[model samples]
Target: MANTSYTRSEELKEILSGQETQLQQKMDEAKDMASFLVELVDTLEVTMSNRSAKGDKEKPLRYCTHIMEQLDALGWDRVTLVDQDLSRVQIELCDASQRKHLITARFPPAYPTIPLTIAPLEVPECEDDQLASQRGLSVGGLSLKQGLALEAAIRQAEGQLEIFREFWDVMQDFDERTWVIDPEKPTRADKMRRCALGNHCSIQVTVQPLSPRSMPDTKLFGPTASIAPMRTKLYQNAGLWDVKKLPRENLEVLLELEGGFPSPVSTNKDDINVGCGICYSFRFEGQVPDQLCSHAKCQQPFHRVCLYETITTSAPKT
Candidate 1:
C-alpha cells in the first residue's frame, strides 16, 4: 500500500509541472499582445498629427503669399493692376520698340495645379480666324491647355510682344502723319484706320496683322467724280507697293497725292471737322457724321440716324 501511494504522488507532481509550463506560455503571449497594441496607438497618433499640420499649411493665405512672391520676382513695375483677392492681375509688357501691351490673367481656385486664363486687354475688334488661332497663349513651351506657373506665363507674354511690334509701329506712323477721322481714340487693337484726304474725301484701310506692309483692303468715301481718279490710280499703281516702306509712304506713291496726307495739326479745323449738315453740329449725340450725300454738287455730310430719319419721313405715301 505504501508503494501505491508513492506512484500516485509522482503522477500528481508530473500533472502540476505540465500545467505550470502552459501558464508561463500564456503570460508571455499576453505581454506580446500588449506591446503590439501600444505600437499601434503610437502609429495612429503620429499619422493624425501630420495630417492636421499639413491642412494648416495649405490654407488660402499660403496660396496668396506664394502668388505675391512670384509677382515680386517678375518685377512689380510690370504689374499694372492686381485685385485684392489675387484672382485677377493685369500685366503691362513692352516690346523691343518700347511699345506696351496689356494682358489680363485670371486664376482659378486651384491655380498652379490648373492653368490660368491669359488674354490681351485690348483684342482686335475684327480678328480673323487665322489670327485668332495664333493668339493662343503658350507658356514655357507648353500649350495653355496644360498647367502654367505664373512666372512662365509672364515670360511667354514678353516674348510674344515682339511679334506684333511692327504692326503697332505702322499704325503709329499713320496716326502721327495723317488726320485720322475714324477711331478718334485709337488702341493697340485697332487694325483699321480711316484718314481724311481733304475735300470731304476719306480713305479707309484695313491692315494685315501678320503682313503689315502688304497691300491693305482699301475703300474710298466721297463723290464718285472725286473717287474715280483715286481708284484708277490705286489699281494702276498697286504693283508699285513696296514692302520695305512704311504704310504712309506706300499710300503716297500709290495715289500720287499733291501734298502728302494732310497733317492733323496744320489743317484748318473748319474744313476737316465738317458737322452733320442736318444737325448742324460737329458731334451729334456723341457721333460724327460718317455718311455723305451721294450727289456730286451737294456732297452734304449727314449722320446715319439723321439720314435714315429724313429718308423714312420724306418718303411719298407708300
Candidate 2:
C-alpha cells in the first residue's frame, strides 16, 4: 500500500509539472501578442501625426479666404468671374489709355506656398515669343515666384498693361482709320494688319510692339502688274518713311496711291475686285482668293484651290 501511494504522488507531480509548462507557454504567447499590439499602436500614432502635419500645411480653407479678401480689395468691378470651388478667377484690368484686358488666375490647393499661374485671355500672335520667354505669363515686367501675394501679382499685371498701351494705341488707330481686310475683329494682341488698297491690292504690315513709331515689315498682295508700280514706289520712297507718323500714314506715303485706301462703307459690293470670280464669294474657308489672273484686262481673282481643281479636270488623260 505504501509503494502504491508513493507512485501515485510521483504521477501527480508529473501531471502538475506538465500543466505548469503549458501555462508558461500560454503566458509567453500572451506577452508576444501584447508587444505586437503596442508596436502597431505606435505605428498608427506616427501615421496620424504625419497626416495632421500635412493637413495643417495645406490649409485650403485659409487659402480660399485669403483669395476672397484680395479680390474684395481689388474691387468687384475688376472681378469678371470666379469659380465655385475657388480654383480659378478672372479679372478685368484697364490700362492707362482705358483699354480693358482680361487675365485669369489659377490657384492650387497649396497656393501662396506655391506660385499661382496667371495668364492673359487674349494674347497676341506676335507676342507668343515674348510670352514663351516669360513662362506663358503676360506679366513680362514681373518675375513671379513662390509666396508672391495676389495683390502684387495684380499690380505687376497693371504695370505690364501700361507698357503695352502705346502699342495698342497704334493698333487702334489702324482699326479706326483704315479698312482692315483681314482679321475682321481686331484684338489688342494683333500685331499684323492687312489693309485694302483698291484694285484687288492689299498691303500687309507687321508692326513691332516695342517700336510702334518705326517702319513695319510690309508686303503687297495683288496681280504682278498692279503690284509692280507699288513695289517700285515702296523701294524708291523707303527713305521717306517717317518715324514721327503713324503706320497708316507711312504706308500711304510709301505706296503713293492717287486716292487713299477704299473705305469699308464706301466700297461697292458689285465691284469685281471684292470677291473671287470663280466662287463669287469674298472669303473661302476664312481666306480671300490671293491668286489673281496675270492679264491686266481680266484681273479676275481665283481661289488657289479652285484654280487647281479646274486645271486638273481640264487636263487630258494619258
Candidate 3:
C-alpha cells in the first residue's frame, strides 16, 4: 500500500507538469499573434503617412479602413484618434473585467528622423493591473504578447515621428555652418525662438501608470515624450505668503501669478490707472497683457497694459 501511494503521487506531479507545459505553449502562441497584429497596424500607419506626404489624400482613408478592420477582427474598441498637425491617438482597451488599458501615441511633424511616442495610460491607483500577469513568468520573462501589442502601437507612432523629423531636418539646413539662419539677431534676454515647424507642431504623449522600464526596446522614430503621475494640487494662497521673503523654490509662484485679490484690474489691464504696475486688466486687440513682478527678485509690480504703453509709447513705432 505504501509503494502504491508513492507511485500515485509521482504520477500526479508528472501530469501537472505536462499541463503547465501545454499552457505555456498556448501563452506563447497568443503572444506571437499579438505581436503580429501590432506590426501590421504599424506598417499600415507608415504607409498611410508616406502617402499623405506625397499629397495622396484618398490613400489615408483607405489605410485607416484597413486598420479598423484588422482591429475589429481582433476584438478591440474604445480607441480614439485625433489626426491633426501633430498626429495623436488615444487608445483604450479593456478586458472582460472592464479594467482600462490605455496607450497614447504622438506623431509630430518632423518626418522620418524624429520618432513617435507611445505611452501607457495611468489609472489612479491600480498600476500593476495594466502590466501582464507575472504569476508564472520567470526572471527576465516578459509577456511577448503584451509587449508586442504595445510595440505595434509604438512602432506606428515612432515611424510617423521619423518622417516628421527627417522633413524638419531638411528644412533647418541652410548651410553646414549656419543651419538655423536668424534674419534678426536675438536679444540676450529674449526666449530662444523655436523652429516654426518644430515649435508650432509637437507630438505630446501622455500615459498613465506606465511600467517602470528603462526604455522601450524599439528604436524611436521621433522626439521622446514623458508623462508623470498626476501630482496632488500643492497650492498656497499668495495672501499668506511673506512678500518680504522668497521661498527657495517659489512655492507661492502660481498664487502670486494668479493674484490673491480678483481686482477687476487683475482680470483686465486696459482700464487701470495710467501708471499702475498691474496691467493684465487692459488688453487691446494687438497688445500683450501686463505682468506683475510676482517673483521675489524685484517684486516691483507693473501693469501689463501700462508697462507696454509706457515702453512702446516711449519708443516711436517704426
* Tens digits of lDDT, candidate 2, 1-318: 111111224423322333444334444554465654464346445644664566544435556777888888888888899877677889888888888888888876545544578864454434456643554343333334434566778887777566567778888877876677677677777788887776777788888776677888888888888888999999999999898888788877888755655665656545426568788876788877878887868887788887888899999999
TM-score of 3: 0.23
- Residue 260 CA displacement from its true place in model 3, Å: 13
Model 3: per-residue lDDT, tens digit, 1-318? Answer: 111111224423322333444334444554465654464346446654765586543423433454445346534455565454335567665433333344565543332223445553332221344232333221222112232333465444333233223222222221111211122333211212211112111111111212211111111111122101111112323334343332211222322323321223232322222223344322244442224344544333344566667888789768
lDDT of 1 by residue, 145-179 (tens): 22467778878767656666788889999999888
Model 2 clash tally, residue pairs: 0
Model 1: weakest 10-residue lDDT segment is 1-10
Model 1, which residues run further than 4 Å from truth?
A: 1-59, 121-146, 280-291, 308-318
Q: lDDT per model, in order?
A: 0.70, 0.69, 0.33
In model 3, what lDDT does residue 284 have? 41
- TM-score for each prediction? 0.70, 0.71, 0.23
- Candidate order by lDDT, highest to lowest? 1, 2, 3
